[model samples]
Target: MTDTLIQTLDVALGERSYDIVIGPGLLGSLSQHIETVSPTARIAIITDETVYELHGQAIEQALAGRQTHIIIRPAGEAQKSLANLEDILDSLFRAGFDRSDLLIAFGGGVIGDLAGFAASIYKRGMPFIQVPTTLLSQVDSSVGGKTAINNQFGKNLIGAFYQPQKVVTDTDLLKTLPARQLKAGYAEVLKYGLLGDPAFFDALEAGLGQDILDLDEAALTKAIHVSCATKAKIVAQDEREGGVRALLNLGHTFGHALELEAGYDGDLLHGEAVSVGMEMAFRFAVEQGLCPVADADRVSAHLAATDMPRISDMTHLLHDPAALLKHMGQDKKNESGHLTLILPRKIGETFIEKRADREAVLRFLTQLRDEA
Candidate 1:
């Protein structure tokens, strides 16, 4: 629980494996890690305006003597687009950065995704590091090799599985995060528990949830470590989501649909959408006889207790079940025109239902809309 305590977890991918270093005040030691991974590589730090303003000086001081270029974009989910990716690539080319150079994604999920995608395709390929500042990015996006940019069709429609050279998560940076964003990130933390660890879920329900939301050092660190450890194990087992990795998308199918309906206009944060989506997943499972009503109620109760978003809180965006269904149809998980959903058989137990009945999904949405 001390600020000096650091925990390291590895995503074992044979030749591509890397370590995720988690601790408070990690930025101070970032340069050493970077040097170890890309000692002779020139650096390009890609960050959004907000993050740069908040912690730019610290990062600059950390890598003081290293050759580096800073690229700062406007902060928001909207920035994760093809246009921005092109702009970043252009900047890298203009700066004469090459495959041997290093790129650092120095913000939340958006920056991580955009910069990561750029690194993936820049001159065939380039090594990159993730210095994720936000809680959401630290625990989830930063650990996975899934880098992407959004298109008009849907979220992360264009992307590649490009692993980073390293991930440095400084928990201290989270002190500046808005309460809402922090809560949003906690949704992903809750997710690892809901998806596979019942004991973790129980711990959350028993006050660990509030401890994390309150930013208690020990609690927050434990949550982050456990979430990343769970994800690392899964990614190592299935690097490209070929099989078990799909379980990580437990609430994402429904969540991404809600996000599309919200127009990605910042109205609904990704974690918030996932919060509601997870509840919906549990309820839908009950409807399908895959789970019990009691399990569904527990899921809802936990979200409500923690003040996380639920279906009732997002009624305005849930007005049209048909439209939501349309968005769901576009989910990347679909195969052969059949809906692929990650549904729960119970808390801590989830399975990929690749052949989900489309009409059944529609009816489920309709029922949710009516209730809302």
Candidate 2:
């Protein structure tokens, strides 16, 4: 249980395999991960306003001797937009970023997602490192190379599975994060347990206490390392979300819909959405006879213990179930005119299912508002 630091490796396909560094004091060691694969022209650190305040200069200072520019956008999920991309590109150009310039994501999932997307498309793909500061990003978003932005359609609608050169997980940075954000980020951490490994969930449940107000370096590092390894295996087999990787989306289908309805406001953090989404997915599966009601309840209890949102509160985001369903239909994961659902067959086990009937989904939505 006293895992202060650990070195783990994940093999991503296409000549892009890399190691994940997890431990305390990682923020200070970020420079080690920034690869000079080729001659680099410049460096750009893209993060949101909030993250920059926390470790912007620390990261920039890590690359201090190099040519670096920092792009700090206003904090919010809505910031992930074509407009923001354009602004970031402008900043990169102003900072003299060329074909070989590097981009490092120094925030939670949103910033990591945005920075990765920017790196992938800029000048026909540039180098980028994931310096994920939040537990959610460290464990989930920053590891997989899945970069994206949102739109009128839904969350992460526009994105690519572009892998990062290195994932720098500094658990130290998490200590300064607000408790609410910390709890919200743990949703994704718990996700690895929900989808693939039940043991990790048990560890998280036992380790995460009400007084987790301060970061326990050992606990945080273990969670991040395990989740990253899980993602690495899934990504290795199916880097483009072909099959096994879809398992990672256990709560995302339902979660993304809620985030869009909330307009990516600070009100619904990504981890919060996923936590509730995972619960809803399980509960909906139980409703459809795909799983037991007890399974759904257990999922709810785990999320609640971590201070995550509840699926029963879906109605709070909106009044009409049809509207939410409509949003779900627009999800990128949907296929062949039928929405896909990642449902849990039981607690600690989930899978992607396409058998969810439309009426059943709508009926559930009609009741979501009441729960909200």
Query: Which stretches of candidate 1 lie above 4 Å from their native place?
Result: 1-4
lDDT score for candidate 2 against the true structure: 0.77
Of candidate 2, the 10-residue stretch with the lowest lDDT total is 205-214
TM per candidate: 0.98, 0.93
* Residues 273-342, model 1: lDDT tens digits: 9999999899899999999899899999999899999989988987898988888888887889989999
Clashing pairs in 2: 315-368, 315-369, 316-372
> Over all chains combined, what TM-score does candidate 2 have?
0.93
- Clashing pairs for model 1 are none
- State the displacement of the C-alpha of residue 62, model 2, in Å, after optimal TM-score superposition: 2.0
RMSD of each: 1.1, 2.3
